[model samples]
Target: MILTVTLNTALDITYRTAALIPHTTHRVTEVVERPGGKGLNVARVLSALGHETVVTGFAGGRTGDVLRELLGAGATARPADGRHGRRGRPRPVDALLPISGSTRRTIAVVDTATGDTTQLNEPGPTVSAAEWTAFLSCYDRLVPGAEAVALCGSLPPGIHVGAYAELIRRARAAGVPVLLDTSGEPLRRGVAARPDLVKPNADELALLTGSRDPLRAAHDTRRRGAHAVIASLGPDGILAATPDGLWRAAPPAPARGNPTGAGDSAVAGILSGLVERLPWPTRLSRAVALSTATVLSPVAGEFDATAYEELLPRIRVTEHPAP
Candidate 1:
């Protein structure tokens, strides 16, 4: 099973309207709420792809209750006994730990007419020192059973900037491959731990490596400590720099829709491929295809299955020598 960690979990709420205009009152057409945070988003995509995924992190208060409810009645610590039952089918499970502070909410206002998304994100709840200790204990137990782990999203207040780095170390010690998807200082520190893979969007890559060029930034990031770097280039697709070689994967045509969670989908694809032992080119193709399919969906953390199936054969992955 793939284990995903969202240190700062969120209650994702999306508001859809006919048109989005500032300084004016507008009527909302639709509202959708789901359990979110980057790792949860990756878990959702992995689950949709028919993988058994376990999600762990901080959750508390009313929002946390609702998020767990959405995950099903069994989203708790007890079910995470680190044992996969010999059942008929495998499904996604939530093992989020409780905290004192209430979970945060992230709102996305989608303009249906123009397909524009404006997001307002809360900073998330503060985690205490005790809570962090408890989470690490739980994570250690989970890591041994996991085939791979994804250390994702931002660090909440009271948590150390090197949280992901520590988690990566634990996963490595357990002999489980780890993929890190985060930004800024957390990513910088985490990369120093030499994760199996790091997925950073173009902007995040630029911020970390001080290079506008994705290829150059990816290589630089690898040199910093990451075993491999997969830089998301938005519509241009993904540029991956791995020990095996360098490659670029792009969709046959640009997809249009909500871009939020697209990178998470790509992370899911890559992790899924890793656990399945797929080749680098095939893995890159799957990541690009999944990301494109996610862009075609209006909702975050979901992708159009039809689009994914159709685009899988069309994604182009080209290998190049490392610079």
Candidate 2:
């Protein structure tokens, strides 16, 4: 089973309008809501990919209740037919702990005309000391059973900056392969904990290494401590630097649509590959294909199955000279 941790879970609400105009109200065309957070998003993709996945983190108040309900409701929304491979063990299990503060909500307003998204994310609920302790206890139990663990997303208010680092250490001690996807100081500290893998987008990579060069930045991140670094380069695809080798994986063409959960999908791909013991090149191909397919999907935390299957074998994974 794969374990995913989403400390600051959210209710992701999406609004669709014909076009977004400044200082003008527009008619809403559609609305969609889903349980979200980087880790939860990864869990959704992993579960869809037929991996037994478990999700744990913080959930409280009305919003938290709603988040858990949505998460649970969509748990088994997978194909029973042989399509997209065999079904995983009944979707992602919600193991979120309760807290005093209400969970946060994120709004994504999509312009149907331009296909652009304007996101408004609220500051997540502040976690208390007691809540943090409870989370640690929950995490401890889940780690032992996980084939791999993904520690993802931003830290909520009142949590220590080194939270991911601490989690990484615990996962490592259990001999579980761990992947981290976050940014800022939490990411810095988490990387130093030497996770099995780290997935950072282009902007985060540039910020972390102070270099705009993807190859150089990936190398620097590995030096700082990650055993492997898969830097997402958006439409250009992803660059991977691992002990096995370095490779650049990209689809033949750029995918167009909402790119919201592309990175999380990539995380799922890599995690699935890790658990299945696939080679680095094959893993990179899956990551790139899944990420691109997510961009072609209409909403976040989901991907187009047809796009995924069509793009999977076509993704190019070419080795790069060591830096």
Q: Superposing every Cα of model 1 onto the true structure, what RMSD results?
A: 5.1
Each prediction's whole-model lDDT (CA): 0.88, 0.90
- When summed lDDT is taken over every stretch of 10 residues in candidate 1, the lowest stretch is 76-85
The residue-by-residue lDDT of candidate 2 on 1-323, one tens digit each, is 99999999999988889878889988888877789998999998887788889999999899999889888877323345534434334578989999999999998888887878898999999999989999999999999999999998999999999999999999999999999999999999999999999999989998889999889899999999999999999999999999989999999998877788899999999999999999989998999999999898655557888889999999998998776
Per-residue alpha-carbon lDDT of candidate 1 for residues 1-323, written as tens digits (9 for 90 to 100) = 99999999998888889777789998989887888899988887787677999999999999999988977642322123323222334556879999989999998898887867889998888899999999999999999999999999889999999999999999999999999999999999999999999999999999999999998899899999999999999999999999999999999988877788799999999999999999999999999999998888645657777789889999999999757
TM-score, every prediction: 0.93, 0.94
Error of 2 at 167 (Å): 0.5
| Candidate with the greatest TM-score versus the true structure | 2
